[model samples]
Target: MTRRPSPPQSTLPSDPILALRANELLARGRQLESQGKIADAARVSAELVNVAPDLAEAHQFMGSMAMRTGAADIAAMSFERALQLKPRSADLHIALAQALLALQRPADAARILDKGRTLHPNDAGIFRELGQAQLDLGQPDAALKSFSRATKLVPNDLYSRHMASALATTGAPNPGYVAELFDSYAGTFDAHLTGKLEYRVPQALAAALAEHGPVAGPTLDVGCGTGLVATTLPETLRPIDGIDISEKMIAKAQERGVYRHLRTGDAHAVLADEPDFAGPYGLIVAADVFIYIGDIGDLFASLAARLAPGGILAFSIEFNEAQGIAIRSSGRFSHSPAYIHGLAAANDLSILAEVSHPIRLEREIPIPGRLFLLRRG
Candidate 1:
């Protein structure tokens, strides 16, 4: 998480003695930070309040240090104090917005970002953060507008452009956007998905794959977040390879120690670009990954070329009534059953089994999707 710029000594208390001391202490803190003495810097920042209680920069430094050390609650409190001292500071508002997001107060973060917009109407960074907050709150329409505003304000920033384009139409998702989105969710992903959301795609996929038989040999786990699917894999399938766009998710997956190799990139490209891959892959599994992928024709082509004869490709997809694929208002894609079956046949793959189930809970309501097992013919 990046913090906004700190105010200079000129923005501190008017008393010459207090301002000089605050500046001196701020310089020492910087030197300590440069030397990797983070705790010392934090201690110095804490002492600044005693000398210059009215200095917003001191509280800003304290907030930055707290955020650095993962004390989001403390960071929020410090940032709130800084904001109170400098109510109209755009930078302080942005800092507080980020802290609120870390604390799972996205609605509050959205409101603060709105405040920031009023202060810095032309600042693209404010719009970007506002878009993220809106998206996190499940208001994609609002997020789309905010992201569009960011792209308009910062035309040179490709990231904002990509996000706007991705949301503009139903097409292939922007890998960069999806990666960053999941990276932000990585810390709380497992708990939120399994605990309150009731994510059971992995368990269901494993059950279907086992019942289908020949569950043997190497496996490729696409979007294998935290290796939840790998836990149920047969021991014979040693050295599973997992591919995900998020580096943080890969880090969490590595903790499971079940994967032989894990890489960060688009799953389709990661699997397609494996030059050393000799024999056909025995099994390839994707649990709730395709939702981020709108059209699967390209992925099917890659799988048709690499999947072993009689080897199975198992995955889950959100259900949709659209004629083909549709990106939900929440920014997730859903595939029509007719679309999946049609694509499978066109790609020389035979559907082994397709089961309808509630994939997960969205706002505590069941989200229905289908799990399919496809075999290369």
Candidate 2:
């Protein structure tokens, strides 16, 4: 998540007249932001930056406004200028790191945060952000150390504590963690998954669906990221409803115009609330979603109750040889076939088909996966 900037701290110009104007503009910008006039606030900040180019606070405020407006590139540039004007400010370094992370440049963010940590070793904020950057770069061990240090520095910080625990234990991460992770990832999810990771589960699930006869009722796509399932499936499954945790991902999915409905929330809670979700779906597809869930027994139960008679529930899992589910350091879960079989039996759902494939490439190594089609009795 992008961190919002603190209130403006103006460095008045030397000239009394210019200083008076700068102070007025600065106050106006703060007032506009408080009143939710983000565009107006951005204009005010831009004007301030123009009038006092040497004022680091003006540039910082400009960057914060750009961040609020979703102009991450502009925010990064503005933050860089702020840092150049005030090299000693830890706040500037932190803001710049946030902009870089928003732009999906984790390496650069990590570098900046590393420097920030050097400059302010005791700052918990720097350690927390540095941990996130490390996690993004696939360095869980390093991230765990960073988060642990943050926890030590600020024991009351729940975010840091939760992150440290998630990395250290074999449990599902907090919903907020998943939401933030995907929100940051939503921009490049498609290309990173399909191109770099060789993700083909969506298309493979589509082909598997073809073997079944016509879908008997409305369909649902649980945890549908970017509408990949809707896009890959045959047009026969139009008007699919979707639920996901990330709003940014939901927005991208909405842009595809394939889904009839979409909402942002935990899939488990939505699936369990049948009256609200009104499922009884003909088909429910969850592509590459189980990796985030450590124990999916409750989810399976919910899905079973929502399926229409003879309805097909299709999903994918990172496969493992162990008897149950296991979460790795990479913050993804892998399930053994035995665990899935037990879920089907407990839910009274019959396994219709199972296909094993490479779900994606992690560090050039294939990650094994299993796609299953289960039918409600």
Candidate 3:
């Protein structure tokens, strides 16, 4: 007769020795994870689960590992199991919500975050996560309220406070906020922007440049998110330099191998970094970049100083033509033609061409905007 092995335990033990051993195993697993030994950590966690199946920490470790591997569905299952074992764990709730969001279940993530908020009313992190979920779910009004409540809970938290205030007022978005937004968004930026948002600014800019017949010079693309602008350029066009605030965005653009160089920093600060390049670029582009910045005088002055004489500066802006500058509810800045052209004139740049170029789709209607090409004196 063959001997049969015992089935694995389905429940944790209450015995002193078993409990102590389980704790030791869990601690070892966590230590391995802390040391960046993910495989070792996973093996240890599996051992812990085999010995003590109801251990939430083991499940949580597996959940985190799954998340890091981009197995969001597995992560969600592990987190849900952990939640069943430890229903009151706020951190588990957050992890589960994050997995759900990554899985494209923003509404479900919002629900999980809401449950977390009910348990921990003062947890600003939960509120922030909830707000993000709401925003992704197209409930911007609800997101604004959640963000406001988060800032109220933690007054000194610059990110939540900035987002809350920026959502409520007409002001330029903080550069850090813009960078942080895009850093998290980099994974889906190209697909979401081009396919869903109907963004054609980069292609439009290329076509506009092409009208000038094989335009070529030392060029710079400000806020070159994923370097989509490079696709529209003529073969004769130079490998343009690029700058962006988000390191993730810069990395994505680098993978495209289009730019002469890519830099991660504030676009305003990059404007001042003369050592990063030769004297001045003959063509400077701000394709959809100025939407994050309201006041243009300072930027125009910097562009004028950095553009060689007779060099070109091309850019785009969302315009309603009602005000010199307006901050939309979406937290983007829009400017009127008067505002941009005034700055160009004040900076001694001549507007060579201005065309109505609407790119983004809102409720199936194109958003009003303009693309302008200017020349330095």
Candidate 4:
């Protein structure tokens, strides 16, 4: 008689009690991760790993926990270990690739996934992550191919949509799409953005203001998000005003009681309508605002008309090349230093100082930003 086939190795419970404890711990770990308690999740997952050393799920959780804590090396180690236990798990391979990508080892990530694709040929998630790895490696063409496959596999994927849009606009003109994306997410702006991103636009603007002389008159806080910058201003700066395109944001700013006047309006148009704005504002501040406005010519002209002679204008801009301003598929605009200088000179403003820093984002990714201080000539 033929011998009965051995039971699947992965089906073993090791011990019923141990399996029950591992399950309980894993559930708690997931809940903690959902609550953004990454440290706690890691701790729980570590316990689960001890109880169920061969469990791929436990190792995957540990990898995710490590990544949340900025422990990329540890995350990579955890993912690699998990892959060894579940060599056929496509999700684990993708997770491993992400960890490798974070460690700036795109070539290694690509190699890992190249093997994974052969083992699990139809996995869309793997292709999507492969695209990201290629993008990180400065191989946009390869990225496009992988992203294309991902979109075909899962048409409604937002991440894939964003990636595709980004690739399409790599060398294209400002198509006015990024603003729409921001406007759509304007409602949940502060809830998802604030501390998670370590956002400190107000602090940066305040520092820029301090470097210049005191604000002798009223001030304008342009694109004032939740009045963060407004509340940070010194009490000596009387009649601080704020303007933004989102009424919901202005309403939130109003709750802070920082601005003497808070209006919901377009920044470019607001200055033009107030033809007599000269004496009211000795300073105009735009923190993390210009990224949405592609053409600074009209905005600068409007600002120049509104400023008192020798009045200072302070703002932050995301940098791009001097030769061109490309609107990314995300619809956000990036400007070059040369473009900024041109706008300042045309508007009769002299650049006093410029400082570059990593701007905080809600997802913990930092983007490059420049703070500029200009005096009306």
Candidate 5:
């Protein structure tokens, strides 16, 4: 009895025409979005949702459109409906959690992501999202575990590795880690740093520079995140040039219309090798730049080479009281006063002025730091 294995079963909807219609609408909406007709794509998504209220894909499409349009509330509702229709779908769970996170409900997002992880134990994205949710909830230990798991799953993911490193409270973050961090953060950086963290490094550094009389030639802004230093400096220090690791951050800095030139690169390598950035410049400012940079010995040597005679090199550091660098749990590295003084002397740079101040706030607590103005002999 060669019982032909019963004909392969179909998973298509009972109403094939309706399923076809829904798929066609989804494609059209995606096409519209791809063509940059965002409003039209949104309207198509809305129509799809109405035509196929029971279709999980239709609701997901609507939710994605809402999210793209910054309608997090609408996105949340649509994703919830999608999740209801596809309870076991890992993508649906992630979508709902993202919507919840955007709504500032990290606890809720964490709950959803935890459930998603339970169901799909091997999903790296779920672990990554869960880590972010846990971090938002101030669960660093839990976030560390999640990020570690994600790193284990996707081994080469820089963001996961960096988050793990930050949580482990050790190791100098790699350049890739710093670039990825600021690129993703560039959008909200200015507001968050200035408003929430009460960052005043640029202002303080500018004040210090003003004391040195007038700076001559073009000034260089190192690790110039969003051109804050360029904007804060006096007009006398015009024709400013800036370099940063993150392209997105560089774009933001460019939008400020302050710098004569802006470059996206590791300041260490750029200053050492790039001819355009190489300058026997009058002033080089690195406001709050040393946090991401663990070792400045090489950087100091580079700065010494670039500085014109009597050129000023001004910078700030998260002040570590210990006699060496400390990798803080915040993923930032702090340097001791002794270390900076030693480095400056070794690099033939004389300390002009040193000011200890509260650079910014972390968790509403002021973080102590030091600003140093060094002069090339």
Candidate 6:
């Protein structure tokens, strides 16, 4: 199982009266930030900086506030100062690397990340940022290494999932562990996935459907979260159906009125039960849904069996070129292009079109999104 790094403990002095005052101010600032009063938090953080200019914690807090407020330059300066004081802090290095990336100085970010890894080689967050910096610098090979290290260090991190996907662009095999990790996250899936991740699988599927013309009979939106994709379906295709493993997510999807049917069940098993679902669906769409399934052989085979002849299957996946599909300690599977092609061919599905593009997540990270339009032969 992938382990997350524990939250950092407060190291600031709690005994000295002056230090206690600074801690109080910092605590208040954090509360304000959590309450969405970023401006007020900044003001408090500024006061902390004045009282403890050499305090690494103070600088780090101010840096986070600046970054949150779109003050990238200021954030960088604050983080730099913090690093100078606490050069061993891996979290500080990650923050500084992010600020540098915001300023499009990936090379510099990579340098800091290297130093961070040296200090905290076992920290997954350091490797994640390092991998991201390498990717931004167009060093796919290096990025792949960093991401691989990150998954080993912190297999459960979703950031590692994104990093693994990015590295896959270099034709590296997909990381095998991502699927089960995602399946675990499926409980809180919609709440954590939408709005930020620019999860356009739903949108991409909609676009594919639009390009192909109307979906003919009943339709199923597999792994439909919050009904974002289901709602996008044309009204003519009423009685749209959706299925997901997370009951909480299915509830949210139902609230959107996008699907005539919504059920909480395994995607593969759900379709298997509905053998007659074939021909009823003019289209079957899975957006950003297959990343959690390590082996698409079963999924593709099941989908082909469920589709009518000439019926389309549109879905989104985070592609990887990694070899031999295997599950990682992280629980998600990365797919190789060969693996994807093999699945399509084995299932008797013809790939009509496939497009690769950047997918944005909630934290402004751009993940690679692969869209495939398949027709069952």
Candidate 2 accuracy as lDDT: 0.84
Off-target runs (Cα >4 Å) in candidate 3 are: 1-150, 154-160, 163-170
lDDT string for model 6 (1-377, tens) is 99976543434555487687888998999999999999999989999987766678898999999998878899999999898877788889999999998877889998998888888889988887887777667576777788788887776666576557644642222343333444466566655566445455666667777887655757778777667777677776666788876666777787787676777777777777754343357788887667665556666777777777777888876656566353222223445567777888888888887888555442354655578888876
Q: Cα lDDT for residue 369, model 6?
A: 54
lDDT for model 5 comes to 0.84
Instruction: Between candidates 5 and 6, name the one with more favorable lDDT.
Output: 5
| lDDT against the true structure, each candidate | 0.81, 0.84, 0.79, 0.75, 0.84, 0.72
List clashing residue pairs in candidate 1.
none
Poorest lDDT segment (10 consecutive residues) of candidate 2: 322-331
For model 2, residues 279-325, the per-residue Cα lDDT tens digits are: 77888888877788677878778878888899989999999886486
**Highest TM-score model number:** 4
The estimated TM-scores of all candidates read 0.61, 0.60, 0.60, 0.74, 0.62, 0.69
Pairs that collide in candidate 2 are none
lDDT of 3: 0.79
Q: Candidate 5 — which pairs collide?
A: none
Please, what are the lDDT tens digits per residue for candidate 5 over residues 128-175?
888888877868788889989999999988878877875675435655
Q: Give the TM-score of candidate 5.
A: 0.62
Candidate 3: count the clashes: 0
TM-score of candidate 1 relative to the true fold:
0.61
Question: For residues 251-325, what per-residue lDDT tens digits would candidate 4 score against the true structure?
Answer: 788888777777667777766675434344778888877776656677677776667777888888777655445
The sequence of per-residue lDDT tens digits that candidate 1 reaches over residues 72-148 is 88889988888887888888888998888877788999999998899899989889888778867878688789888
CA lDDT of 86 in candidate 1? Answer: 86
